[model samples]
Target: MDVRSSAVTIPAGNADLPADLLVPAEPVGVVLFAHGSGSSRHSPRNVAVAHALNEGGLGTVLVDLLTPDEDEVDSVTAELRFDIGLLAGRLAGIVDWLAAERPVGGAPIGLFGASTGAAAALVAAAQRPDLVHAVVSRGGRPDLAGAALGQVRAPTLLLVGDLDEEVIALNQQALGQLTAPAELRLIPGATHLFEEPGTLEQVAEAAAGWFHDHLHPQPARA
Candidate 1:
């Protein structure tokens, strides 16, 4: 199955953010990614997971929340990373655009987020409950989602590395705060980035499985 890929640039708050879209010949669901702080859409780990999802018949969009100029500044200031409201607003705009332009037809939409990006994803999910079906956070800092945590209705999966003890505790707290059906899976032997050998594959599988479970097929008639 050859997947067709395209480069899309969406207007994000007066700037154009580059995105790479991968869709199967026949897509089953769509997973939009929110890259971690200091990590662009070019992050190899997220790209690898997106490839795996494409192979599993899912469509993927790896988008940069910040333009190159803003990213450069944030790379040093770390201010943009914590601006959950701003990032979430941009994500919601993209979601609305994709919903209008794509052939997804109310197909379940899932968010795959990493690091501080997870907080943005959560806020977007809370704001657009009608469109977002599920969410998966990979080594995410969901604690930054703030009060939005209690507003999320979509099923969510939080994956963290066992060796990332601090994050594991944070995710545990986020799990308790989430009003949605949610679970926390700690990948043994993995660190905050899941750089450990074979751990990323585990992250990919867990994400794909979570999307599969939460994105329901339109009601089937007997």
Candidate 2:
């Protein structure tokens, strides 16, 4: 499949975030990535996952959630990254932009969020219930999404590292609060970063399968 990859600026809230957009020919869906704290669009982990999704015929948008200035402030104070409401509003704005712009030409939209960004993704999904089709969280802090978890209508998949017991527990609690179709999967022998050999590969495979199933669902038999 021929893939078009480009650097684009996306308007989210009051900021214009830099993003990398990759769309394969005749994509099944488009997934927007929300990276974790202190991470940008250049995150190696997310880049790897995006590559897998693209190979699976899904378009991907990897955007920096914070502006350069905001990132500088966040680096110093470590506050903005944890500000779930602000991050969620920006993500919602990006969703609106994607919907109106049709960069992927009407492909179903999904979100892949990491760390605190997962909370923002859930909140954005709740805010745009009719637009976001599916969500996947990796080593995510979904509990930070608070009441938005119950409001989210999109099918959500929570992937946690089994060795990261605290996050696994948090994901389990969030899983129970979710009112939509949801599942919690543990990556064995992995920690929060999934840095162990072959572990990140597992994350990519699982995420691709989840998006493919929900974003490109087959028509029901008559």
Candidate 3:
């Protein structure tokens, strides 16, 4: 599929968020990535998944949830990294910008979040049940989403690594509260970062499939 990439600045209150958007030709949906703690849109794992989604004819938006100054402050005090409400509010701002711009021509939106960003994604989805079509979390701390889990209406897929037992337990706890269609899949022998061979590929595949299923209909089988 033909794809075009661009650097975009989105207005959010007093701040402007920098984002890298990849739009594929004849796209079906757009996936917005919410970065994890100490990570940005430059995360190799998340970028790999975004590439796969692009190949699958989906548009991708990778944006920084925190400003450079905010990240610098968090690097020192470690205060804002876990601020789920703040991050979710930022994600909602981006969603609103996307809706108004309609850059992808009214395509459905999906959220792909990692680590703590997953919690923010859930909160954002809950806040915009009418706008978001689906949500996918990779090695996320859904437990951090708290009461927002029960409010989310989008279909959610929680992907965890077998060796990431702590996060898996957290995911299980969060899964119980989800009234929406939700699934938890464990990638065998994979660690939290999915650094092992072919592990990250599994993450990409599962994410692409989930978004395909929820954001749009399954591609017709050949």
Q: lDDT per prediction?
A: 0.89, 0.93, 0.92
lDDT of 3 by residue, 36-74 (tens): 999898999899999999999999999988899999999
TM-score of each candidate structure, all chains considered together = 0.94, 0.96, 0.96
lDDT of 1 at 200: 100
Cα lDDT of model 2 overall? 0.93
The candidate 1 region of ten consecutive residues with least summed lDDT is 213-222
Worst 10 residues of 3 by lDDT: 213-222
lDDT of 3: 0.92
* CA error at residue 26 for candidate 1, angstroms: 1.4
Model 3, TM vs. native: 0.96
**Candidate 2 per-residue lDDT over residues 1-222, each given as its tens digit:** 688999899998789999999999989999999899889899999999999899999999999889999999999999999999999999999999988888988788999999999999999999999889999999999999999999999999999999999999999999999999999999999999999999999999999999989996334336
Per-residue CA lDDT of model 1 for 96-143, tens digit only, reads 877877744445688999998899999999998988999999999999
Task: Count backbone clashes in candidate 2.
Answer: 0
lDDT of 1: 0.89
Ranking by TM-score: 2, 3, 1
How many clashes in each candidate? Answer: 0, 0, 0
Model 3 residue runs over 4 Å out of place are 217-222
Off by over 4 Å in 2: 217-222
